[model samples]
Each structure stands twice: as structure tokens, then as C-alpha cells.
Target: MQPSPLAAPDASWYDIPGVRLVGAIAGALFLVAAIRAMFGRK
Candidate 1:
């Protein structure tokens, strides 16, 4: 069986110094875009 991708999330993600914060910002932007799309398509 194939292993799960998120089995060790903390260990693999954002090992670099400033990458975690950038990831957070990107996530927030994606969420905002998703919400806007959801609301605007009505």
C-alpha cells in the first residue's frame, strides 16, 4: 500500500527559515479566493 502523504506533516514541511510564514500567507490567500468564489457564484 502507498503511504499517506501527510503522515509526518510537521517533519517535512517548511524546514527553511522563512518558508513557514510564506506558506501561511499563501494558504490564507487561497482560502480568501475560495470564499470569494463561493459567494460570488451565487
Candidate 2:
């Protein structure tokens, strides 16, 4: 059976250029924050 419109699978990450780029930037920022929390200057 086919999925309903509201229940359809999401597009592949690379399919949306803008969202992909934004997600990458956000992920990088979070990674930097985590590293800083672990070893940041007091």
C-alpha cells in the first residue's frame, strides 16, 4: 500500500541543498561547542 501524503518518507539529505548546508553548519557548531566544553580555557 502507498503511504499517505503526510506520512511519506522524507527526501534524502543531499536532495535539498539549502537544508543540507544549514544542517552541516549547525552540526559543526554543536561539535565545536562540545569540544570547548571538554577542553576550553577556564
Candidate 3:
């Protein structure tokens, strides 16, 4: 059976270019923050 249009179970929002770009930026920011926190002080 085919899935209904309203039931898009395979919808990958992150696969979109805009979402990927935003996600990449967010990931980079979070990674920088984590690195700073890990070695910000002795």
C-alpha cells in the first residue's frame, strides 16, 4: 500500500539545503562553545 500525502513519514526536513545550512551553523556554534568550555580554564 502507498502512503497518503498527509502521512509523509519519510519527510526529511533536515535534508533540505536551508535546514542543512542552519543545522551546520548551529552545530559549529555548539562545537565552539563546547571546546571553549572544555579548555577555557585550568
Candidate 4:
């Protein structure tokens, strides 16, 4: 049988330095903006 197509996630995916926090904060802000836009809030 062929092995499962999905392999375990790479450990290095979590090893990024410095930019992780910035990316997370930016992502959160983007989500907030998206939600507000969707709800037509000021």
C-alpha cells in the first residue's frame, strides 16, 4: 500500500525567529479588519 500522502509537519515550521510575532500580530489585525468589514461596522 502507498504511504499516506500527508507527512508530519516540519519541526522547522515553528523555528522562525523574530518575524513570528510580527506575523501573528499582523494576522490578528487582518482578521479583525475582515470581521468588521463583513459586519459593516465602523
Candidate 5:
């Protein structure tokens, strides 16, 4: 049976270019923070 429209999952959010851009920026920031914390750098 097919799922109803309201019950279906929407993936349109990932289709936007800005979503990927923001995700990349956030990931980079997280990595930077993690590295800094690991080496005890301010």
C-alpha cells in the first residue's frame, strides 16, 4: 500500500544548494573546534 501524502517523508530540504553549503560550513567549524580542544589550544 502507498503511504498517504502527510505520512510520507519529505527530503526536499536536502535538495537546496544552501543546505549543503551550510552543512559544510558547520562541519568544518566542528572539526576545528574538536582539533583545538584535543591539543589544548585556545
Candidate 6:
């Protein structure tokens, strides 16, 4: 079933720069962890 018109997803509720920075940091952390695991380092 589809969402109602009043319940449609909205993209304007977020602070763009804040969201981007948080996402970037999380991505970087994930990459670093992956690299460390692959290299068998603590």
C-alpha cells in the first residue's frame, strides 16, 4: 500500500549541512574500521 498524500516522505525536515557532516564522519569511521580489520590490526 502507498502512503497517504499527507504522509508522503519529506526531505526538507533535515538540516542539510549537519546531515552531510554526520554522514561523512560515519562513512569515514566505517572505512577506517574496515581497513583495520582487513589488515588484522587492533
Top-TM-score candidate index: 5
Query: lDDT tens string, model 1, 1-42?
Result: 887985864665567667899988999999999999989686
- Candidate 2 structure quality by residue, lDDT tens digits, 1-42: 878876538777678679888998999999999999999968
Q: What is the C-alpha RMSD of each candidate to the true structure, in Å?
A: 7.2, 3.3, 3.6, 6.2, 4.1, 4.5
On lDDT, the candidate that comes out on top is 3
lDDT of 5: 0.85
C-alpha displacement of 8 in model 3, angstroms? 8.4
Model 6 stretches with alpha carbons more than 4 Å out: 1-10, 13-15
**Candidate 5 per-residue C-alpha lDDT over 10-30 given as tens digits, one digit per residue, 9 for 90 to 100:** 658678679989999999999
Could you give candidate 4's per-residue lDDT for residues 1-42 as a string of tens digits? 775667555646557676788889999999999998999775
Task: Please write out the lDDT profile of model 6 over residues 1-42, one tens digit for every residue.
Answer: 878887537656355568877888999999999988999675
Minimal lDDT window, size 10, model 6: 7-16
lDDT by candidate, in order shown: 0.82, 0.85, 0.87, 0.79, 0.85, 0.79
Per-residue C-alpha lDDT of model 3 across residues 1-42, encoded as one tens digit per residue: 887878668769975679988988999999999999999978
Model 6's alpha-carbon lDDT is 0.79
Model 6: lDDT of residue 4: 82
Model 6 collision count: 0
Number of backbone collisions per candidate, in order? 0, 0, 0, 0, 0, 0
Q: State which candidate, 1 or 3, has the greater TM-score.
A: 3
Off by over 4 Å in 5: 1-11
Candidate 1: misplaced stretches above 4 Å? 1-13
